[model samples]
Target: MSQFALLGKRRFAPFFLTQALGAFNDNAFRYALIGMATFRLGMSSQALSTYNNIALALFIAPFFLFSASAGQLAERMEKARLIRIVKAMEVAVMALASVAFMLASPGMLLAVLFLMGLQSTLFGPIKYSILPQTLHPSELVGGNGLVETGTSLSILLGSVAGNALMAVPHLGPQLASAAVIGVALAGYLASRAIPPSPATAPDLRFEWNPFVETWRVLGFTTRNRTVFNAILGISWFWFYGATLTVQLPLYTRNYLGGDASVLTLALALFSIGIGVGSLLCERLSGGKVEPGLVPLGAAGMTVFGIDLYFVRPHEALLREQNWWSMLSGAGGWHIAIDLVLIGMVSGFYIVPLFALVQERAERSQLSRIIAGTNIINSLFMVLAAAFGIVLLGVGLSVPQLFLTVAVMNAAVAVYIFTLVPEFPLRFFGWLLVNTLYRIRREGIDRIPEHGPALLVCNHVAFTDPLIVMACVRRPVRFVMYYRIYRLPLLRPLFRMAGAIPIAGAKEDPELLQQAYDAIDAALEAGEVVCLYPEGGLTADGEIAPFKPGISRVLERRPVPVVPMALRGLWGSVFSRRDNFLRRARLPRRFRARIELVVGAPVAPEGVDAAALEARVRELRGAEA
Candidate 1:
């Protein structure tokens, strides 16, 4: 289903609105404060800069100081109740903010900023952790997409509203004050409608010491290798975005200038780009949490970021006109496209990682894990600000800063992908399968979202494993013929996938036993292990007699065996129609129509090779 449809469901809509309103109020209050200080207060440049820095720091400090405790509190209470409570806190903060605005006191407004940050920090953990509890595993990606879309757009609108409202002549402060409190009240109302979500961890031991518990929270987060790295990926995204956006006003005024309207235009393009890209995730991933899109997004961000340096006007357009003049000027479209693409691809890069963390982290510890991520995110954003300030202070131009970040993104992406090779492996599989086939899946969700499972399928082509990997969201370890596993073009992906290389028992008994050992171990660890019970790719577009490898795998592991079939791949380029010589195959369809028909899993207790083969043949039907 389209992610937009989620906005209509009570399961998602209320929580979405509450979160969106909170984001809206946040940027609205912050930007409006900036407008008031810069325009109304007659503060000097130095005082204004100091105030902005202090405000940013005040906002970030609570995530470090209170996020872990907030996460624990969320775990202790029912989630909907906690969210409503948080929203109530927001209302109180905004009410105080209204008083601060009326007083026109920077000191009081700064205190309100810290309190707002505290409220946001309290909401952050539940924001991410609640999703997996509320959403189906299949809906995870689509749900994340909607949340991200709502967030980016809200931020843009809030920023615009804050600035516009604060610029009003006599009632700027009153307008800003009224808007924030109204938004807070609205958010509280929305939160009240959220369905009750039972706490995942009840009767858990409490930790009250912030410093010690903070260390423990972060330490526990590192225990899951993939989840920790995904968290890092998210932090890196915040760092990249913070650094880029913080420089935009100066970038607009100095580099792409026509007027301040150009800054708003640039911001709109980037923000809308994120919204567009976030909404696209549901369709692109086919409702699965697919991280294969990360590398693609990272690559796009790097490419366009570099292109941005070259496409900008060497000198600013110092005209009296606004964004309209810039939009119709030379290379304007190039600049707009670069920013939007950066935002769009960043949307692709971030949504999957967030879903991956929520989907993979333990439910009981999920809130704490999210809290750890928030802490890391806070640090990264601070570092981003520092990084930008240092580099720009030293004399780097804004465009040069963009280039440096783009290059650093390439480096960081490689490091992360190396740490978790599943990302690139899935990338190759997803890219290859999608490019070569128009695929359909039936009963794919029956493959199971968790725990040990043995998947037995009829291998129709060399691309069989890739097909299954792309369709199934969870990682699958395959036991395949050693030669096939060693395919020159696909070897890296296979190695990354942990495909166990097997030889015939007669040819190499040691290797056969080794493959069995690996499969057994993987299943014991609650991983899905897939192997073609037919032993090899079909030579004549027909199912071969099932081999005994299935028996050996189940003898030790005794896991559920999921039967799957690959249809319409027998005549494809990767099929054995020409005996493994790719160029020699005739009638090899590119972008071929294909289907993966999955049967309900058979209990390991009574499953057998012949029965599985029969089931697979039935599922395949007459497609081959």
Candidate 2:
């Protein structure tokens, strides 16, 4: 089903609306306060600046103080009930904000900002952790995409509404106040329609101390190295985004020489770009949590961000032009496109990391992990603010800052990819398979979701491992020939994937024993191990005899063996059809159609190498 189908379902729509409205209300109230401080409060420029900064700090303080406890609450309490409580609290907070608006008291409005932040902090853990329970594994990426798109749109609309409504002559504040209250109440109503989502850790003890719990939650996030690095990647994205967004107004005024409408134009383009990119993720990922897009996003961010620095408008055009005038200017479209693409790639970068964390983290500790992520994200954002300040203080132009950030982004991506090689490995495999073949899989669901299993497949070409990796949802460790495993270009990827490399016992008995030991250990730890039972790629367009080594491995592990076949790959360039070098000179077989067919698994007790080979050959009937 299309991911949009989710928008119509009771399982998703209500929660989505509730969350979007909450975002709308938050931004509306925030911009309303800023509008008051800027134009209505009659304060000095320096005082207004200080007040704005203080307001931001007050808002972020709650995330640092309460996110850990909030995570624990979500895990321990029923999620739907908790969401309703949160919505109710938002209504109360907005009601107070309305009073602050009426009284025109800066102190009261600032307090409301802090309260709204606290409310968001409380909702953060529940917001993310509930999705995995409510949606199917297949819908996780799509669901996240929709949520992100909705939130971005809400923020855009809310900011516009808040500023526009507050500019109304005499009753602007009253209307703005009423708008936020109404939205908050509507959010509460939407929350009422949310179906029940039970707590993941209902029996767990609650940790009330925010400091201790914060440390404990962060420790849980680090328990898995990949999960930890994914969280870091998420945090870095927030940092990058915060830096760019905070500079937009300055960038518009100084570099683009545009007015207020132009700033709004830039913001709108970015928000819409993010919405477009986020919605596209479901289709691009084939309804799975595909981290392969993350590298693409990072690379795009750097490329376009650097390009943005060079796309600056001439200073002569800096004279009081409106958004339309700016658009008609020479360099205007370039700047707008750069901003939009940056936001779009940001969507690609973040959604998968979120899904990866949800899929990989311990289910019972998922809420806490999300809370930890929030804490780290907040920290990064705070650091981004400081970094921007230091750069500006050093007399760096906003465009120069953009260039510096792009460089920093590249460095950070490299560091994170090194820490967690799975991301890059998956990207390489995804890129190679998708670029070279139109892959179709049949009966892939027969592969067990968990526990040990031996995957026996026909080795049709040198790229078989990558093709299988791209098609399967679960990670598979391949048992490959030592020569292929050690191929200079593929060695790092193979090692990262934990592929076992084996040689003939007579040639290297120690290495062969180590390969068998690694395979046994991987299977015993409940991982899938794939073996090309044909032993090597076909020199002819035919299945080779099955190697008895598979039977020997099963004798020790006694795991069920799934038989699979690759069709239409025997004649590919990767196969030794004529000769490796000779085939390379032939026309590239780009996007060639191929299929992977899986047969029902055989029990360990009844499995035979020849029988398995026959089953695979049957699956690959015409191709073999």
Candidate 3:
């Protein structure tokens, strides 16, 4: 079953609702506070700005201050009890907010903000740690995506409700306060539904000192390079988002020249985009954590951001009109379209990074690693604020600031991609294979986990190797003819993938020797090396005589051979049987089901090339 389908089952549904409600209430209360400051209290522009800035500082500061200790607490205690206590704290904080709104006291509002921040800080550790307890490893990404999408949607809805309710004049604060309290209460009830998540480190000592705990948690991250990098990627995303979201109010008022509706539109667009991207992650990742999408997302963010700078909202006439007026205006559609794409791609950018972090991190220290990530996020957010100030000082307008952020995104993406070429290389290969063919696979479990292994498959199409590479998580070195390996368009891909090029003895003895040496090295390093036993694609859609090259490799390295087959590509242009233009017109759409069937591995000593070839042909379900 798909990961998301597991979440719908009773074990996960309640916990999902609780977390979603907590996010909802947090935004609802914050927006309610903003609404009161703007209208009910007759606050000055300076005061409103100061209030918002202080609120941001107050909330984020707690994450850095308390996350380390809180993470350890989650690891040490029963997560269920801690979540309940946090929910209770939310109740009390919202009650205080009720009194603050009623009395119009700024002090009480700030206190409520700090308390809410503390509540979330306590909730953060348990929030992530609880998932693994209830979910299978495969379900983690989908569950995380659902939570992310739900949180974004809730914030969007909560902001609207808070603003709408707070506009009710006399009863605004009362109604808003009541609604927030009710949401918190509902969250507590949902917490009851979450199955008990046992602590991973039950006997672990709980440290109260944040500084000591911070380093301890960070220590756990040093062992895993991928996990550490994934955390950094997530932290970078926070910086990107905080830079944009925190500036929207100013951007809306000054650049867009619209009222509240402009802010609403921008936020709604961004959130909706994130939701779209998050949901689509499953399909894009093919049920595995793929970080290649990170660079893709970062690239889009930069390109669109730079474009947004030259967009000139005022030129589009979006600056002077209401939401409805803007929609009706000419060229407004262009700006709207751009914003939507930016938001959607940003979503695409973030979801996989989170999944990658979770998948790679050690289960025992996952919460601590997450805590370290939160600390880094807090630091980046502060940096974002500082960066924005510098940009503002240099005479950049809010729209121009957006442009600057976009360009910076490109630089950041390049730096990360360069540091980890695997991500980009895999993404490039996956893009080609997925776009080119409607591929399928069965019994892929027969593939070996490690060591020198040979993959023997019926030669089918030009793109078959790429298809196999995409489906298999581990990287493989394919042995192919020197000419085919050096094909104009395919050469760069082969180079990145480390494909070994060979030649027949009559063709080039030196190249053949290099190919053998490379294949041996790959086997010694415990990598999968794939080869076509027939030495070329099938011309008449039938199996050819078995060649001894497969046996020669086995005689040298003696690794397990996984027999695989590809079907449904015989008549296509990519297949050897058809001309390019003729093959391109066939194997129409969703009807294509090309299977990669892996039969049981053959023991090396007894295996012969002809026997292996016949076995592979049988696995392919081919009549010939």
RMSD, each candidate, Å?
A: 2.0, 2.3, 4.1
Give candidate 3's error at residue 524 in angstroms. 7.7
TM-score of each: 0.96, 0.94, 0.84
Model 1, C-alpha of 69: deviation from truth (Å): 0.6
lDDT of 2 by residue, 185-259 (tens): 999999999999988889888877799999999999999888899999999998888778766655665667765
TM-score sort, best first: 1, 2, 3
* Candidate 2 lDDT for residue 265: 78
lDDT (Cα, tens digit) per residue for candidate 1, span 418-447: 999989988888899999899998998898
Q: Give one digit per residue, the lDDT tens place, for model 3 in 1-624.
A: 665686678777887788889988888888777767755676654455556666777777888888898888788878887788888888888888888878878778888888888889888878777776776655766887787888888888877777667768688888988999899889888888777778878888888788988888778766676567767777788888877776666665555665566666777787788877787777787765666677778888887777777766442334545666665555456667777777778777778777776666677887887788888778787787777766766766667777877877787877776655666877776777777766676776567643568888888777778778877655678889899888999797678778899999889999988898899899987789888878888878898887887777787888888888777777653765545545445543333456677888877887888898788888877532
TM-score winner between 2 and 3, please give it. 2
For model 3 the local lDDT of residue 62 reads: 83
User: Evaluated with lDDT, which candidate comes out highest?
Assistant: 1
In model 2, which residue pairs have backbone atoms overlapping below 3 Å? Answer: none
- Model 2 local distance difference test score: 0.85
Runs off by more than 4 Å, candidate 1: 37-54, 103-107, 313-321, 487-490, 578-586
Error of 3 at 94 (Å): 2.6
